[model samples]
Target: MDIIRIEQLEIFAYHGCNEEEKRDGQKFYVDANLYTDVMTPGLSDDLEDTVNYAKACKFINKFLTENRFDLIEAVAEQTTRALLKEFPKITKVDFTINKPNAPIKLPFGNVAVSVSREWHKAYLSIGSNIGDKEGYLNQAVDMLYDDENCKVGAISKFIQTKPYGPVEQDDFLNGCVEIETLYSPQELLKAVNAIEAAANRTREIHWGPRTLDVDIVLYDDEIVADSNLFIPHREMHKREFVLEPLVQIAPYAINPISKKTAEQLLDELRGQSENVNSGCAGCQGCAMRK
Candidate 1:
Protein backbone atom coordinates (compact mmCIF):
# COMPACT_ATOMS: atom_id res chain seq x y z
CA MET A 1 0.00 0.00 0.00
CA ASP A 2 1.04 3.59 -0.68
CA ILE A 3 -0.21 7.12 -0.07
CA ILE A 4 -0.77 10.08 -2.35
CA ARG A 5 -1.33 13.24 -0.33
CA ILE A 6 -2.98 16.41 -1.59
CA GLU A 7 -2.59 19.11 1.04
CA GLN A 8 -4.80 22.16 1.55
CA LEU A 9 -5.85 22.81 -2.05
CA GLU A 10 -7.88 25.99 -1.71
CA ILE A 11 -10.94 26.67 -3.83
CA PHE A 12 -13.73 29.25 -3.88
CA ALA A 13 -17.14 27.62 -4.06
CA TYR A 14 -20.79 28.62 -3.44
CA HIS A 15 -21.71 25.87 -0.96
CA GLY A 16 -23.35 26.87 2.29
CA CYS A 17 -26.61 26.77 4.22
CA ASN A 18 -26.98 30.53 4.63
CA GLU A 19 -28.34 32.52 1.69
CA GLU A 20 -25.73 35.24 2.16
CA GLU A 21 -22.96 32.64 2.33
CA LYS A 22 -24.21 30.93 -0.83
CA ARG A 23 -24.40 34.18 -2.80
CA ASP A 24 -21.16 35.63 -1.46
CA GLY A 25 -19.28 32.33 -1.62
CA GLN A 26 -16.39 31.32 0.63
CA LYS A 27 -12.92 29.80 0.58
CA PHE A 28 -12.77 26.04 1.19
CA TYR A 29 -9.60 24.09 1.85
CA VAL A 30 -9.49 20.43 0.94
CA ASP A 31 -6.97 17.84 2.03
CA ALA A 32 -7.04 14.26 0.87
CA ASN A 33 -4.89 11.13 1.13
CA LEU A 34 -5.60 8.49 -1.44
CA TYR A 35 -4.62 5.03 -0.22
CA THR A 36 -3.84 2.29 -2.68
CA ASP A 37 -1.26 -0.21 -3.89
CA VAL A 38 1.32 1.62 -5.97
CA MET A 39 3.65 -1.31 -6.45
CA THR A 40 2.53 -1.95 -9.99
CA PRO A 41 3.24 1.57 -11.18
CA GLY A 42 6.45 1.85 -9.19
CA LEU A 43 7.75 -1.36 -10.72
CA SER A 44 6.89 -0.49 -14.27
CA ASP A 45 7.22 3.32 -14.11
CA ASP A 46 3.94 3.39 -16.00
CA LEU A 47 1.37 6.10 -15.31
CA GLU A 48 -1.39 3.70 -16.35
CA ASP A 49 -0.69 1.43 -13.40
CA THR A 50 -1.23 4.04 -10.67
CA VAL A 51 -3.21 7.12 -9.79
CA ASN A 52 -1.91 10.30 -11.45
CA TYR A 53 -2.06 12.88 -8.67
CA ALA A 54 -1.83 15.85 -11.01
CA LYS A 55 -4.76 14.68 -13.14
CA ALA A 56 -6.67 13.71 -10.00
CA CYS A 57 -6.21 17.17 -8.46
CA LYS A 58 -7.43 18.81 -11.66
CA PHE A 59 -10.53 16.62 -11.53
CA ILE A 60 -11.24 17.49 -7.92
CA ASN A 61 -10.78 21.19 -8.56
CA LYS A 62 -12.99 21.20 -11.66
CA PHE A 63 -15.67 19.12 -9.95
CA LEU A 64 -16.06 21.50 -7.00
CA THR A 65 -16.15 24.49 -9.33
CA GLU A 66 -18.89 22.87 -11.40
CA ASN A 67 -21.10 21.41 -8.66
CA ARG A 68 -22.80 23.47 -5.95
CA PHE A 69 -23.64 22.20 -2.49
CA ASP A 70 -24.87 23.61 0.81
CA LEU A 71 -22.35 22.17 3.25
CA ILE A 72 -18.65 21.42 3.55
CA GLU A 73 -19.66 17.86 4.44
CA ALA A 74 -21.42 17.51 1.15
CA VAL A 75 -18.47 18.97 -0.70
CA ALA A 76 -16.08 16.55 0.97
CA GLU A 77 -18.29 13.57 0.19
CA GLN A 78 -18.85 14.55 -3.40
CA THR A 79 -15.20 15.30 -3.95
CA THR A 80 -14.13 11.96 -2.55
CA ARG A 81 -16.65 10.14 -4.73
CA ALA A 82 -15.58 12.05 -7.81
CA LEU A 83 -11.93 11.34 -7.21
CA LEU A 84 -12.57 7.67 -6.68
CA LYS A 85 -14.74 7.51 -9.75
CA GLU A 86 -12.00 9.10 -11.80
CA PHE A 87 -9.24 6.90 -10.43
CA PRO A 88 -10.17 3.27 -9.92
CA LYS A 89 -6.75 2.61 -8.40
CA ILE A 90 -7.76 4.33 -5.16
CA THR A 91 -8.60 1.91 -2.35
CA LYS A 92 -9.63 4.26 0.45
CA VAL A 93 -9.51 7.95 1.13
CA ASP A 94 -9.31 10.19 4.19
CA PHE A 95 -10.78 13.48 3.03
CA THR A 96 -11.16 16.78 4.84
CA ILE A 97 -12.96 20.02 3.97
CA ASN A 98 -12.19 23.10 6.03
CA LYS A 99 -14.18 26.30 6.29
CA PRO A 100 -11.96 28.89 7.95
CA ASN A 101 -14.50 31.70 7.80
CA ALA A 102 -17.84 30.39 8.96
CA PRO A 103 -20.57 33.04 9.19
CA ILE A 104 -20.81 32.87 13.00
CA LYS A 105 -19.50 35.87 14.89
CA LEU A 106 -17.63 33.70 17.38
CA PRO A 107 -13.83 33.58 17.17
CA PHE A 108 -13.52 29.89 16.46
CA GLY A 109 -10.52 28.97 14.33
CA ASN A 110 -12.25 26.86 11.70
CA VAL A 111 -14.99 24.37 10.98
CA ALA A 112 -13.90 21.13 9.35
CA VAL A 113 -15.41 17.80 8.44
CA SER A 114 -13.56 14.62 7.57
CA VAL A 115 -14.60 11.12 6.60
CA SER A 116 -13.13 7.82 5.32
CA ARG A 117 -14.58 5.65 2.60
CA GLU A 118 -13.31 2.41 1.08
CA TRP A 119 -14.60 -0.35 -1.14
CA HIS A 120 -15.96 -3.37 0.73
CA LYS A 121 -16.06 -6.90 -0.63
CA ALA A 122 -19.27 -8.75 0.10
CA TYR A 123 -20.43 -12.30 -0.66
CA LEU A 124 -24.07 -13.28 -0.73
CA SER A 125 -25.80 -16.65 -0.87
CA ILE A 126 -29.02 -16.10 -2.78
CA GLY A 127 -31.77 -18.64 -3.32
CA SER A 128 -35.47 -19.05 -3.94
CA ASN A 129 -37.62 -22.11 -3.37
CA ILE A 130 -40.93 -20.69 -4.54
CA GLY A 131 -42.05 -19.08 -7.81
CA ASP A 132 -39.57 -18.62 -10.66
CA LYS A 133 -36.39 -19.31 -8.75
CA GLU A 134 -33.92 -18.40 -11.48
CA GLY A 135 -35.96 -15.34 -12.35
CA TYR A 136 -36.01 -14.30 -8.72
CA LEU A 137 -32.26 -14.76 -8.48
CA ASN A 138 -31.70 -12.81 -11.70
CA GLN A 139 -34.02 -10.08 -10.47
CA ALA A 140 -32.04 -9.84 -7.23
CA VAL A 141 -28.84 -9.62 -9.27
CA ASP A 142 -30.27 -6.76 -11.32
CA MET A 143 -31.38 -4.91 -8.20
CA LEU A 144 -27.91 -5.23 -6.68
CA TYR A 145 -26.33 -4.02 -9.90
CA ASP A 146 -28.73 -1.05 -10.08
CA ASP A 147 -27.43 0.23 -6.72
CA GLU A 148 -24.61 2.74 -6.97
CA ASN A 149 -22.77 1.30 -4.01
CA CYS A 150 -22.92 -2.26 -5.25
CA LYS A 151 -20.82 -3.68 -8.11
CA VAL A 152 -21.49 -7.25 -9.08
CA GLY A 153 -18.16 -9.08 -9.35
CA ALA A 154 -19.14 -12.65 -10.05
CA ILE A 155 -22.07 -15.03 -9.86
CA SER A 156 -22.15 -18.84 -9.62
CA LYS A 157 -24.56 -21.12 -11.37
CA PHE A 158 -27.68 -21.96 -9.37
CA ILE A 159 -27.57 -25.40 -7.74
CA GLN A 160 -30.46 -27.58 -6.77
CA THR A 161 -30.28 -28.42 -3.08
CA LYS A 162 -32.53 -30.07 -0.53
CA PRO A 163 -33.91 -27.65 2.06
CA TYR A 164 -32.32 -27.57 5.48
CA GLY A 165 -33.96 -27.10 8.92
CA PRO A 166 -37.43 -28.70 8.88
CA VAL A 167 -36.90 -30.44 5.50
CA GLU A 168 -40.55 -30.21 4.55
CA GLN A 169 -40.02 -27.09 2.49
CA ASP A 170 -39.65 -27.16 -1.28
CA ASP A 171 -36.29 -27.93 -2.86
CA PHE A 172 -34.25 -24.75 -2.99
CA LEU A 173 -32.34 -23.21 -5.84
CA ASN A 174 -29.15 -21.74 -4.43
CA GLY A 175 -26.02 -19.93 -5.58
CA CYS A 176 -23.38 -17.40 -4.54
CA VAL A 177 -22.57 -13.78 -5.37
CA GLU A 178 -19.44 -11.66 -5.09
CA ILE A 179 -19.76 -7.90 -4.86
CA GLU A 180 -17.79 -4.79 -4.08
CA THR A 181 -20.00 -2.30 -2.24
CA LEU A 182 -19.56 1.09 -0.63
CA TYR A 183 -22.11 0.31 2.09
CA SER A 184 -21.08 -0.67 5.61
CA PRO A 185 -21.95 -4.03 7.10
CA GLN A 186 -25.07 -2.88 8.90
CA GLU A 187 -26.16 -0.79 5.95
CA LEU A 188 -25.75 -3.77 3.63
CA LEU A 189 -27.77 -5.97 5.97
CA LYS A 190 -30.61 -3.49 5.95
CA ALA A 191 -30.45 -3.10 2.19
CA VAL A 192 -30.65 -6.85 1.60
CA ASN A 193 -33.53 -7.12 4.05
CA ALA A 194 -35.30 -4.38 2.16
CA ILE A 195 -34.71 -6.29 -1.08
CA GLU A 196 -36.11 -9.43 0.47
CA ALA A 197 -39.18 -7.63 1.75
CA ALA A 198 -39.75 -6.10 -1.65
CA ALA A 199 -39.76 -9.63 -3.08
CA ASN A 200 -42.62 -10.45 -0.66
CA ARG A 201 -40.58 -12.84 1.46
CA THR A 202 -42.24 -13.82 4.75
CA ARG A 203 -40.74 -14.82 8.08
CA GLU A 204 -43.64 -16.75 9.49
CA ILE A 205 -42.10 -20.26 9.44
CA HIS A 206 -38.44 -20.99 10.14
CA TRP A 207 -36.84 -22.19 6.87
CA GLY A 208 -40.25 -23.15 5.57
CA PRO A 209 -40.23 -21.44 2.17
CA ARG A 210 -39.74 -18.04 0.55
CA THR A 211 -39.92 -16.12 -2.69
CA LEU A 212 -36.32 -14.98 -2.21
CA ASP A 213 -33.65 -15.74 0.36
CA VAL A 214 -30.54 -13.59 0.25
CA ASP A 215 -28.02 -14.04 3.03
CA ILE A 216 -24.84 -12.10 3.68
CA VAL A 217 -22.10 -14.73 3.54
CA LEU A 218 -19.05 -12.53 3.83
CA TYR A 219 -17.82 -8.94 3.92
CA ASP A 220 -14.17 -8.37 3.15
CA ASP A 221 -12.03 -10.09 5.79
CA GLU A 222 -14.18 -9.04 8.72
CA ILE A 223 -15.59 -11.17 11.53
CA VAL A 224 -18.65 -9.95 13.42
CA ALA A 225 -20.68 -11.23 16.37
CA ASP A 226 -23.66 -8.92 16.44
CA SER A 227 -26.97 -10.33 17.66
CA ASN A 228 -28.78 -9.40 14.45
CA LEU A 229 -26.15 -10.64 11.99
CA PHE A 230 -22.72 -12.22 11.54
CA ILE A 231 -20.30 -12.01 8.63
CA PRO A 232 -18.50 -14.94 6.93
CA HIS A 233 -22.00 -15.86 7.50
CA ARG A 234 -22.52 -17.86 10.70
CA GLU A 235 -23.30 -21.06 8.79
CA MET A 236 -22.19 -20.83 5.20
CA HIS A 237 -19.25 -23.22 5.30
CA LYS A 238 -20.94 -26.38 6.47
CA ARG A 239 -23.98 -26.13 4.25
CA GLU A 240 -23.11 -27.78 0.95
CA PHE A 241 -25.83 -25.68 -0.57
CA VAL A 242 -23.88 -22.61 0.41
CA LEU A 243 -20.30 -23.84 0.02
CA GLU A 244 -20.90 -25.53 -3.31
CA PRO A 245 -22.05 -22.37 -4.99
CA LEU A 246 -19.64 -20.11 -3.13
CA VAL A 247 -16.71 -22.29 -4.09
CA GLN A 248 -17.69 -21.90 -7.68
CA ILE A 249 -17.39 -18.14 -7.44
CA ALA A 250 -14.58 -17.78 -4.86
CA PRO A 251 -12.86 -21.05 -4.16
CA TYR A 252 -9.75 -19.35 -2.94
CA ALA A 253 -11.42 -17.20 -0.30
CA ILE A 254 -9.63 -18.41 2.79
CA ASN A 255 -10.89 -18.05 6.34
CA PRO A 256 -8.84 -15.38 8.10
CA ILE A 257 -7.96 -17.50 11.13
CA SER A 258 -8.40 -21.10 10.03
CA LYS A 259 -6.92 -20.53 6.57
CA LYS A 260 -9.24 -22.97 4.89
CA THR A 261 -10.58 -22.39 1.40
CA ALA A 262 -14.24 -22.70 0.50
CA GLU A 263 -13.39 -25.74 -1.58
CA GLN A 264 -11.72 -27.41 1.41
CA LEU A 265 -14.72 -26.67 3.61
CA LEU A 266 -17.07 -28.07 1.00
CA ASP A 267 -15.03 -31.26 0.80
CA GLU A 268 -15.17 -31.63 4.58
CA LEU A 269 -18.92 -31.08 4.79
CA ARG A 270 -19.88 -33.47 2.00
CA GLY A 271 -21.74 -36.11 4.06
CA GLN A 272 -22.61 -34.01 7.08
CA SER A 273 -25.90 -32.54 8.15
CA GLU A 274 -26.36 -28.76 7.91
CA ASN A 275 -27.20 -28.14 11.57
CA VAL A 276 -24.64 -30.43 13.17
CA ASN A 277 -22.44 -28.44 15.51
CA SER A 278 -22.51 -25.43 13.17
CA GLY A 279 -21.97 -22.50 15.51
CA CYS A 280 -20.41 -19.07 15.16
CA ALA A 281 -17.62 -19.45 17.71
CA GLY A 282 -16.11 -22.66 16.37
CA CYS A 283 -16.36 -22.22 12.62
CA GLN A 284 -13.04 -22.54 10.81
CA GLY A 285 -14.61 -20.93 7.75
CA CYS A 286 -18.32 -20.22 7.66
CA ALA A 287 -20.15 -20.34 11.00
CA MET A 288 -22.18 -23.12 9.48
CA ARG A 289 -18.96 -24.95 8.60
CA LYS A 290 -17.98 -25.74 12.16
Candidate 2:
Protein backbone atom coordinates (compact mmCIF):
# COMPACT_ATOMS: atom_id res chain seq x y z
CA MET A 1 0.00 0.00 0.00
CA ASP A 2 1.14 3.52 -0.80
CA ILE A 3 0.24 6.71 1.01
CA ILE A 4 -0.90 10.00 -0.45
CA ARG A 5 -0.73 12.69 2.20
CA ILE A 6 -2.61 15.98 2.13
CA GLU A 7 -1.38 18.10 5.00
CA GLN A 8 -2.86 21.17 6.65
CA LEU A 9 -5.31 22.15 3.97
CA GLU A 10 -7.07 25.11 5.53
CA ILE A 11 -10.63 26.19 4.77
CA PHE A 12 -13.20 28.49 6.37
CA ALA A 13 -16.37 26.70 7.40
CA TYR A 14 -19.27 27.20 9.80
CA HIS A 15 -19.04 24.13 12.06
CA GLY A 16 -19.19 24.44 15.82
CA CYS A 17 -21.37 23.74 18.82
CA ASN A 18 -21.75 27.42 19.69
CA GLU A 19 -24.12 29.61 17.73
CA GLU A 20 -21.62 32.48 17.49
CA GLU A 21 -18.94 30.22 16.03
CA LYS A 22 -21.39 28.85 13.50
CA ARG A 23 -22.70 32.28 12.51
CA ASP A 24 -19.29 33.92 12.21
CA GLY A 25 -17.56 30.83 10.75
CA GLN A 26 -14.06 29.67 11.70
CA LYS A 27 -10.94 28.27 10.10
CA PHE A 28 -10.84 24.49 9.79
CA TYR A 29 -7.70 22.58 8.96
CA VAL A 30 -7.93 19.16 7.34
CA ASP A 31 -5.26 16.51 7.00
CA ALA A 32 -5.78 13.25 5.21
CA ASN A 33 -3.77 10.14 4.34
CA LEU A 34 -5.24 8.13 1.52
CA TYR A 35 -4.21 4.48 1.28
CA THR A 36 -4.01 2.88 -2.15
CA ASP A 37 -1.77 0.94 -4.53
CA VAL A 38 0.26 3.57 -6.39
CA MET A 39 2.92 1.30 -7.89
CA THR A 40 1.31 0.95 -11.28
CA PRO A 41 0.83 4.69 -11.61
CA GLY A 42 4.38 5.38 -10.52
CA LEU A 43 5.82 2.93 -13.01
CA SER A 44 3.63 3.79 -15.97
CA ASP A 45 3.39 7.51 -15.20
CA ASP A 46 -0.31 7.26 -15.89
CA LEU A 47 -2.60 9.69 -14.10
CA GLU A 48 -5.49 7.28 -14.63
CA ASP A 49 -3.97 4.78 -12.23
CA THR A 50 -3.56 7.26 -9.37
CA VAL A 51 -5.55 9.91 -7.55
CA ASN A 52 -5.14 13.57 -8.34
CA TYR A 53 -4.33 15.34 -5.11
CA ALA A 54 -5.26 18.68 -6.68
CA LYS A 55 -8.78 17.52 -7.38
CA ALA A 56 -8.99 15.97 -3.93
CA CYS A 57 -8.00 19.27 -2.31
CA LYS A 58 -10.60 21.14 -4.28
CA PHE A 59 -13.23 18.57 -3.39
CA ILE A 60 -12.49 18.84 0.31
CA ASN A 61 -12.69 22.60 0.22
CA LYS A 62 -15.90 22.63 -1.76
CA PHE A 63 -17.52 19.98 0.42
CA LEU A 64 -16.67 21.61 3.72
CA THR A 65 -17.79 24.98 2.48
CA GLU A 66 -21.09 23.57 1.31
CA ASN A 67 -21.88 21.37 4.32
CA ARG A 68 -22.66 22.60 7.83
CA PHE A 69 -22.37 20.53 10.99
CA ASP A 70 -22.40 21.21 14.70
CA LEU A 71 -19.42 18.98 15.44
CA ILE A 72 -16.07 18.47 13.75
CA GLU A 73 -16.52 14.76 14.36
CA ALA A 74 -19.43 14.80 11.95
CA VAL A 75 -17.38 16.79 9.48
CA ALA A 76 -14.48 14.36 9.56
CA GLU A 77 -16.69 11.30 9.27
CA GLN A 78 -18.76 12.69 6.43
CA THR A 79 -15.70 13.93 4.55
CA THR A 80 -13.87 10.62 4.78
CA ARG A 81 -16.91 8.66 3.71
CA ALA A 82 -17.51 10.97 0.77
CA LEU A 83 -13.87 10.78 -0.32
CA LEU A 84 -13.81 7.00 -0.16
CA LYS A 85 -17.07 6.78 -2.10
CA GLU A 86 -15.87 9.25 -4.73
CA PHE A 87 -12.47 7.65 -5.26
CA PRO A 88 -12.69 3.98 -6.09
CA LYS A 89 -8.90 3.53 -5.85
CA ILE A 90 -8.69 4.69 -2.27
CA THR A 91 -8.94 1.64 0.02
CA LYS A 92 -8.69 3.47 3.35
CA VAL A 93 -8.61 6.95 4.80
CA ASP A 94 -7.06 8.41 7.92
CA PHE A 95 -8.69 11.81 8.29
CA THR A 96 -8.46 14.67 10.74
CA ILE A 97 -10.33 17.94 11.22
CA ASN A 98 -8.90 20.63 13.49
CA LYS A 99 -10.88 23.53 14.93
CA PRO A 100 -8.60 26.16 16.42
CA ASN A 101 -11.47 28.54 17.17
CA ALA A 102 -13.60 26.33 19.37
CA PRO A 103 -15.67 28.28 21.88
CA ILE A 104 -13.82 27.62 25.10
CA LYS A 105 -12.82 30.01 27.87
CA LEU A 106 -9.55 28.21 28.50
CA PRO A 107 -6.78 28.87 26.05
CA PHE A 108 -6.15 25.84 23.89
CA GLY A 109 -4.15 25.53 20.68
CA ASN A 110 -6.79 23.48 18.90
CA VAL A 111 -9.44 20.81 19.22
CA ALA A 112 -9.44 18.08 16.62
CA VAL A 113 -11.28 14.95 15.64
CA SER A 114 -9.46 12.13 13.91
CA VAL A 115 -11.09 9.12 12.31
CA SER A 116 -10.12 6.12 10.20
CA ARG A 117 -12.53 4.32 7.89
CA GLU A 118 -12.28 1.60 5.29
CA TRP A 119 -14.26 -1.01 3.42
CA HIS A 120 -14.19 -4.49 4.96
CA LYS A 121 -14.74 -7.81 3.21
CA ALA A 122 -17.38 -10.04 4.77
CA TYR A 123 -19.10 -13.34 3.95
CA LEU A 124 -22.67 -14.24 4.89
CA SER A 125 -24.59 -17.49 5.05
CA ILE A 126 -28.21 -16.85 3.98
CA GLY A 127 -31.08 -19.30 3.81
CA SER A 128 -34.82 -19.69 4.12
CA ASN A 129 -36.83 -22.85 4.83
CA ILE A 130 -40.40 -21.51 4.66
CA GLY A 131 -42.54 -19.43 2.29
CA ASP A 132 -40.92 -18.68 -1.03
CA LYS A 133 -37.43 -19.60 0.09
CA GLU A 134 -35.74 -18.44 -3.12
CA GLY A 135 -37.72 -15.20 -3.10
CA TYR A 136 -36.76 -14.56 0.48
CA LEU A 137 -33.10 -15.17 -0.33
CA ASN A 138 -33.24 -12.84 -3.34
CA GLN A 139 -34.96 -10.20 -1.26
CA ALA A 140 -32.16 -10.37 1.28
CA VAL A 141 -29.56 -9.91 -1.42
CA ASP A 142 -31.43 -6.95 -2.85
CA MET A 143 -31.61 -5.29 0.58
CA LEU A 144 -27.86 -5.64 0.97
CA TYR A 145 -27.33 -4.06 -2.44
CA ASP A 146 -29.66 -1.18 -1.68
CA ASP A 147 -27.76 -0.25 1.46
CA GLU A 148 -25.41 2.67 0.91
CA ASN A 149 -22.93 1.31 3.43
CA CYS A 150 -22.65 -2.12 1.76
CA LYS A 151 -21.62 -3.39 -1.65
CA VAL A 152 -22.64 -6.83 -2.87
CA GLY A 153 -19.76 -8.85 -4.28
CA ALA A 154 -20.00 -12.50 -5.33
CA ILE A 155 -23.03 -14.67 -4.52
CA SER A 156 -22.95 -18.47 -4.60
CA LYS A 157 -25.58 -20.70 -6.15
CA PHE A 158 -28.28 -21.69 -3.67
CA ILE A 159 -28.39 -25.30 -2.48
CA GLN A 160 -31.23 -27.13 -0.71
CA THR A 161 -30.02 -28.81 2.47
CA LYS A 162 -31.68 -30.74 5.27
CA PRO A 163 -32.14 -28.67 8.37
CA TYR A 164 -29.96 -29.18 11.41
CA GLY A 165 -31.00 -29.19 15.09
CA PRO A 166 -33.81 -31.21 16.73
CA VAL A 167 -36.62 -29.12 15.23
CA GLU A 168 -38.59 -30.88 12.52
CA GLN A 169 -38.67 -28.57 9.49
CA ASP A 170 -38.50 -28.49 5.72
CA ASP A 171 -35.13 -28.39 3.93
CA PHE A 172 -33.59 -24.91 3.53
CA LEU A 173 -32.47 -23.15 0.40
CA ASN A 174 -28.98 -22.23 1.53
CA GLY A 175 -26.28 -20.04 -0.04
CA CYS A 176 -23.43 -17.70 0.81
CA VAL A 177 -23.01 -14.01 -0.06
CA GLU A 178 -19.80 -12.00 -0.34
CA ILE A 179 -19.96 -8.30 0.49
CA GLU A 180 -17.80 -5.27 1.16
CA THR A 181 -19.36 -3.15 3.89
CA LEU A 182 -18.45 0.12 5.58
CA TYR A 183 -20.28 -0.88 8.76
CA SER A 184 -18.43 -2.34 11.71
CA PRO A 185 -19.22 -5.87 12.90
CA GLN A 186 -21.91 -4.74 15.32
CA GLU A 187 -23.43 -2.27 12.89
CA LEU A 188 -23.49 -4.95 10.19
CA LEU A 189 -25.27 -7.28 12.60
CA LYS A 190 -27.94 -4.66 13.29
CA ALA A 191 -28.38 -4.01 9.57
CA VAL A 192 -28.81 -7.70 8.76
CA ASN A 193 -31.16 -8.20 11.69
CA ALA A 194 -33.25 -5.30 10.42
CA ILE A 195 -33.45 -6.98 7.04
CA GLU A 196 -34.56 -10.23 8.68
CA ALA A 197 -37.21 -8.48 10.74
CA ALA A 198 -38.46 -6.77 7.57
CA ALA A 199 -38.99 -10.25 6.05
CA ASN A 200 -41.14 -11.35 9.04
CA ARG A 201 -38.64 -13.81 10.53
CA THR A 202 -39.36 -15.19 13.97
CA ARG A 203 -37.29 -16.78 16.72
CA GLU A 204 -40.03 -18.37 18.82
CA ILE A 205 -38.30 -21.77 18.54
CA HIS A 206 -34.55 -22.23 18.51
CA TRP A 207 -33.40 -23.20 15.01
CA GLY A 208 -37.02 -24.10 14.29
CA PRO A 209 -37.82 -22.38 11.00
CA ARG A 210 -37.91 -18.96 9.48
CA THR A 211 -38.75 -16.99 6.35
CA LEU A 212 -35.08 -15.93 6.19
CA ASP A 213 -31.84 -16.58 8.04
CA VAL A 214 -28.71 -14.50 7.55
CA ASP A 215 -25.50 -15.11 9.43
CA ILE A 216 -22.13 -13.47 9.20
CA VAL A 217 -19.71 -16.25 8.26
CA LEU A 218 -16.59 -14.10 7.93
CA TYR A 219 -15.35 -10.51 8.20
CA ASP A 220 -12.00 -9.84 6.60
CA ASP A 221 -9.33 -11.73 8.64
CA GLU A 222 -10.98 -10.84 11.92
CA ILE A 223 -11.75 -13.16 14.83
CA VAL A 224 -14.52 -11.54 16.83
CA ALA A 225 -16.20 -13.12 19.86
CA ASP A 226 -18.62 -10.95 21.71
CA SER A 227 -21.80 -11.48 23.70
CA ASN A 228 -23.96 -10.75 20.65
CA LEU A 229 -22.00 -11.99 17.62
CA PHE A 230 -19.17 -14.32 16.59
CA ILE A 231 -17.11 -14.09 13.44
CA PRO A 232 -16.13 -17.03 11.20
CA HIS A 233 -19.44 -18.34 12.64
CA ARG A 234 -18.89 -20.82 15.50
CA GLU A 235 -19.96 -23.94 13.51
CA MET A 236 -19.45 -22.93 9.89
CA HIS A 237 -16.69 -25.41 9.16
CA LYS A 238 -18.71 -28.31 10.53
CA ARG A 239 -21.73 -27.59 8.35
CA GLU A 240 -21.71 -28.72 4.72
CA PHE A 241 -24.64 -26.41 4.02
CA VAL A 242 -22.42 -23.38 4.74
CA LEU A 243 -19.06 -24.58 3.42
CA GLU A 244 -20.40 -25.98 0.13
CA PRO A 245 -21.83 -22.70 -1.16
CA LEU A 246 -19.09 -20.62 0.46
CA VAL A 247 -16.40 -22.64 -1.30
CA GLN A 248 -18.08 -22.00 -4.64
CA ILE A 249 -17.65 -18.23 -4.29
CA ALA A 250 -14.76 -17.80 -1.87
CA PRO A 251 -12.92 -21.09 -2.10
CA TYR A 252 -9.65 -19.57 -0.93
CA ALA A 253 -11.17 -17.47 1.86
CA ILE A 254 -9.40 -18.55 5.04
CA ASN A 255 -11.06 -19.15 8.36
CA PRO A 256 -8.99 -17.23 10.89
CA ILE A 257 -9.74 -19.73 13.67
CA SER A 258 -8.61 -22.90 11.85
CA LYS A 259 -6.52 -21.03 9.24
CA LYS A 260 -7.98 -23.31 6.54
CA THR A 261 -9.55 -22.36 3.22
CA ALA A 262 -13.28 -22.80 2.60
CA GLU A 263 -12.50 -25.57 0.10
CA GLN A 264 -10.37 -27.41 2.68
CA LEU A 265 -13.07 -27.05 5.31
CA LEU A 266 -15.62 -28.52 2.92
CA ASP A 267 -13.30 -31.41 2.13
CA GLU A 268 -12.67 -32.12 5.81
CA LEU A 269 -16.38 -32.11 6.57
CA ARG A 270 -17.08 -34.47 3.65
CA GLY A 271 -14.30 -36.80 4.84
CA GLN A 272 -15.78 -36.94 8.31
CA SER A 273 -19.26 -37.58 6.92
CA GLU A 274 -17.87 -40.42 4.74
CA ASN A 275 -16.20 -42.02 7.75
CA VAL A 276 -19.44 -41.91 9.72
CA ASN A 277 -21.73 -43.18 6.92
CA SER A 278 -20.22 -43.95 3.54
CA GLY A 279 -22.65 -42.86 0.78
CA CYS A 280 -25.78 -42.38 2.84
CA ALA A 281 -28.95 -43.36 0.91
CA GLY A 282 -30.55 -40.05 1.84
CA CYS A 283 -27.80 -38.07 0.08
CA GLN A 284 -27.73 -40.21 -3.10
CA GLY A 285 -30.31 -38.08 -4.90
CA CYS A 286 -30.83 -34.57 -3.51
CA ALA A 287 -32.28 -31.45 -5.15
CA MET A 288 -29.64 -29.34 -3.34
CA ARG A 289 -26.91 -30.85 -5.53
CA LYS A 290 -28.65 -29.65 -8.68
Give per-model TM-scores: 0.84, 0.92
| Candidate 1 whole-model C-alpha lDDT, 0 to 1 | 0.85
Q: Model 2 misses residue 104 by how many Å?
A: 2.5
lDDT of 2 by residue, 35-134 (tens): 9988999999999989999999999999999999988889999999889888888889999998887888998999899999999999999999999999
RMSD to the native, candidate 2? 5.6
- Candidate 1: lDDT of 94? 90
Write the residue-wise lDDT of candidate 1 on 1-290 in tens digits. Answer: 59989999888888889998878888888899999877888899998888888887888889988988887888888788767666778978899988998888988998999988888888899999999998888888989989877879999999998998965878999988899888889989998998888789998898789999999988888887799988777787668899998899899887654678888888778635434655334455765563
Backbone clashes in model 2, listed as residue pairs: none
Please count the clashing residue pairs in each candidate, in the order shown. Answer: 4, 0
TM accuracy, model 1: 0.84
| Cα RMSD, each candidate | 5.5, 5.6
The per-model lDDT (C-alpha) reads: 0.85, 0.93
